[model samples]
Target chain A: MKKVFAREEYCLGCKLCEVYCVTSHSRSKDVVKAHKSEEITPAVIIESGENLSFALQCRHCDDAPCVRACITGAMQKDPETGIVKYDENKCVGCWTCIMTCPYGAVKRDEYNRNIISKCDLCSETGEPACAANCPNNALVYKEQEEEGE
Target chain B: MSLSLKNPEFLIERNYDRCINCQVCERQCANDSHYYDEEMDKMLSKDENCVNCQRCVTLCPANALSIRQYPLEYRKNSNWTGEMINNIYKQAESGGVLLTGMGNPTPKKIYWDHILLNASQVTNPSIDPLREPMELKTFLGRKPGKLEFDENGNPFPLPPQLELDTPIMFSAMSFGSISINACRSLARAATASGIMYNTGEGGLHQDLYQYKENTIVQVASGRFGVHQEYLEAGAAIEIKIGQGAKPGIGGHLPGEKVGDEVSRTRMIPLGTDALSPAPHHDIYSIEDLRQLIYALKEATDYTKPVSVKISAVHNVAAIATGIATAGADIISIDGYRGGTGAAPTLIRDNVGIPIELALAAVDERLRREGLRDQVSLVIGGTIRNSADIVKAIALGADTVYIASAALIAMGCHMCQKCYTGKCNWGIATQQPDLVKRLNPEIGEERLKNLIRGWSLEIKEMLGGMGINAIESLRGNRLMLRGIDLNERELAVLGIKHAGE
Candidate 1:
């Protein structure tokens, strides 16, 4: 399956992933427009330690825990795409998925206040905005090869 | 005129002159702080929802966004302040314990700031790091007090050691709490930098086995993913008794993060709670701990040094003594202010002592008892900068473990929202989208840069003391002087008050 992998050694901790992520999700999809007026909550985040920095997002594991933990069935894993999907309408904001997620990747969608937000791999573009915009290719979207070297 | 029952902690302001109404804040804020009113042809903001992660502010291309603490006022009561009143209201409504993330935000006594280093005057000539051969190489293992020679009159081999180019090692932050990319970054950095990165109880990932030589695989109470092969793969083994953040508590990895890879590494069922029991079931007493330590030694054929990691709790000095006598080659003391993926608010904030005091006490006790040569001391729990590293060594630490600083180098903003599982910075989350945000390739370089910078700083500090090697500075308390410290504090620290 094609997935985004982090090359942490090259990350500069610029957090431009967050910027592009917000802009991609904005109404106009224009960087300037998003920055000037919108309060876009970035689905992707950058974590920088004193000596290391990298962007973090959803891993979309095959046996996703968020899907299993959602009390309202608001969270689901796409069998075809291997993505964890969230349904805002079905969500009761119980935050069970949030509590169960070990990665701290599912966020509360503050706009609705009752729905959770996560990365959907930017299905429309077939590439994550953060990865697409990464200057150093620290975040890359690619398929994994079969094990055994 | 009346105060609202609750108020937003932060205020969001937009510079209209700079704003082009791009609506970036609306798109970036998961908290829904910004919205565009198409009918009004204007942008609007709701201050109540801002978590102040600064995502909108940082990503703003126009540089139009600003967030600040909301200046809402309450009657000034010293004892029952606004924050206290809010906490009471929250508890009354939710009846749940308030949880926080990251390190202790409250200002406390940071001994590093109060203690100053002494420089050479005339008797000793100070050396410059740029011109002199200053050494920061550190070895973490038992050092023989007296050299034992074989029949050939040559000194016998010393105990196994984890040799490092610098006196620093990345602390144990498991794969479950942080992403694989974060772990890989640390591993790669450690390998390249010639130090070590710990694989906190979460076991070693299959991809990381290549960096095994630089890895310190931890065997915590849970014994998660511990196997014979796992034991043989690392340079050293660390038996984790407790963590600095929650000393008596066990680790809790939410079921949502227990995916296949994590499940495999941890040897737990997918979508199940990965709880590390508070105490190692087999180790209730010091003797039990010794048995486990030896068992590990036997398993690894004693090729690797065994380290026992414990939180710096009360009587740490005595506890450390027991550990050294129990046959641990290295003793790691994590102080109260250490970082964790998630910890109970009460224990994280209240339990455990500062690493500074614990290190000083343990070093003193061990030296006095003539057991100092039997084990190496590694201290951690917010060792911030190079100065703190120097200070820790002079206070008797063989080396220091750094987690928060390493996380910062990788791009963590210290939002302390790790429990939420929605870490915007990828360092601490496992969700595929978030985890991928941290590219190990880039993360490793940043880590290398940070360590290189700190190593230089350490060398400079050593030179300023007119010392050419790091060994000469270890436990050299005379080079340190205390300011605004009591006589008892100074005496315990084994340093004289300034101007004495």
Candidate 2:
């Protein structure tokens, strides 16, 4: 299992991770007015609660319920990286993942298009944009085998 | 009145009969004006996108191409005048400031043409570069007072150094101002050339880490993306005190241009204006400058040399002396006529002194004070050809940094509209669509070719002066003579007018 761990103590409140996440998902790289329009909604959220602030993103679980809850075969785990990914074409305006997830990782586009979006571990590049661009080095990706030993 | 001609298409015409196809036109054409069409089985011309640089026509092997105004007319402005009507239309299109790139291509007096080079006739014999081994290797960092060696016959206590296989170096241009591909091109070229390229105030990107040994990271006043790791990753750290394009004024990467990549690198929020403050808040005096200098040194563990770059201005001599004493390992002075991706027209047109005078004055002042050895000098701002490099070293500089020249090699038309963020050449655009146009592989090869060409010419120029090594020409004023210069100008340059 591959997971992302955040060091909240090192986070500088710069919100670059959220920006990179939003851009990585956006059709265009224009981040200035990315969230202003109704077409795209930010996949990652920067949440602050009682002196603790960190980015909230999808965690691609071992027994993922989002894949099971999807009535349409829109959500599935990739065989290569075991990453939970969403297929917008098969998404039939379902909110099952939004309600079933315990961590509230699923988010809808601003137009209320029932198709949900979340981080896919940036598996295509093997390095997440959020983790790569973090200036403070707060975010890290660790494999389960390496962590266990 | 007749209806204005709409959908007017402009195209270029080339005389292939006179075209030798020597690749000079192909090399200089930034827009791919002339290309050999494989399928068509002939050379094709696309002069419509030409920026009227005249480089292709000027350097053409057979003088085959000449850029002319399109015959298509919007209206018969026989009485109104084409230029006047064009100016009105320009004012209407963008009320915002007009920006451009490259050096001034206007028909101004180029000083190199007026100046003449000396030759060996009676007393000295001229060395042929074809026969003799000419050394053009230039070291940019501070040199030691004396070379140290150990008892075991090995070099010990090595002085701080940066070696350049050639004297040419890629000048400062932030990653945000240009594309990732453009920076990649420079990085690859610098690595291949055994020279250095500067990251102008932009934080180092992860992709450019492979070229870290050949990179010189710059720290300007804003300290936008500066961090501990960025500081330590460079061979040298350049403190940008001022830019020749817009002296005393700071730079502002507009919110629109601040994409996610630039925003992340700068450690600022996306879409917010990245303001580079004109002056460092902590540096109000020379003492404060010293403190920051030592602070950086301490942070880097004294491994990398620190260079302080300043625009040439009146009293630059005094400023240079102060910067040297402030513990800087190198001093880079930019003349007023330097090129910039985006600068206020008012600032670019006016401000500071020419490099020739500024370099001479600073060298004289430093030598008089016996502090010339304290720091190495690197001059820039309109160093066009290898002759300028030779003249600059003979005047006083140890090496020179070039940006516009390098860009020209990488297919920049010098259209001078870099501020608009729609650069056609992909050298000065932040937009992803435009940035993708430039291929780094081709761009790097072009930069390598330019440096190689300039290096050969510089070596030839040195050989013409009967100098075997570049060191022999450094501060050797006897080889240079000024023409059409008054006594005061001659005295300032510490050289005599022609026929003295």
lDDT tens readout by residue for model 1, B1-500 = 24446678889998777665656567545567899889987778899877677767876666778888899978888988887787777677777877767776656788888899989889999999998788989999988888999999999888899999999999999989999999999999999999999999999999999999899999998888999888888999999999998899888899999999999999999999899999989998899999999999999888899999999999899999999999999999999999999987778888998888889999999999999999999999989999999999999999999999999998887878777776655677776656765778879999999999999999988888899889999999999999988988888888999998
Each model's Cα RMSD: 12.8, 14.6
Q: Report the C-alpha lDDT of model 1 over A1-149, residue by residue, as the tens digit.
A: 77777767666565678767777877878777775577666787667776477777887877888888888888889888888887779999898987888778888875667777788888766778888877558778877563211
DockQ of each: 0.10, 0.01
RMSD of candidate 2 to true structure, Å: 14.6
Q: Model 2 in CAPRI terms: which quality?
A: incorrect
Measured by TM-score, how close is model 1 to the native structure? 0.78
Tell me the TM-score of each prediction against the true structure: 0.78, 0.66
Candidate 2 lDDT for residue B419:
73
- By lDDT, who's the top model here? 1
Q: CA lDDT of A100 in candidate 2?
A: 89
lDDT by residue (tens digit), candidate 2, B53-141? 56556544344677766675656766776644654555566666545454444344444444556768768888899899999887766
Which residue runs of candidate 2 sit more than 4 Å off their true CA positions?
A1-149, B1-110, B147-156
Measured as a fraction from 0 to 1, the native contacts recovered by model 2 come to: 0.00
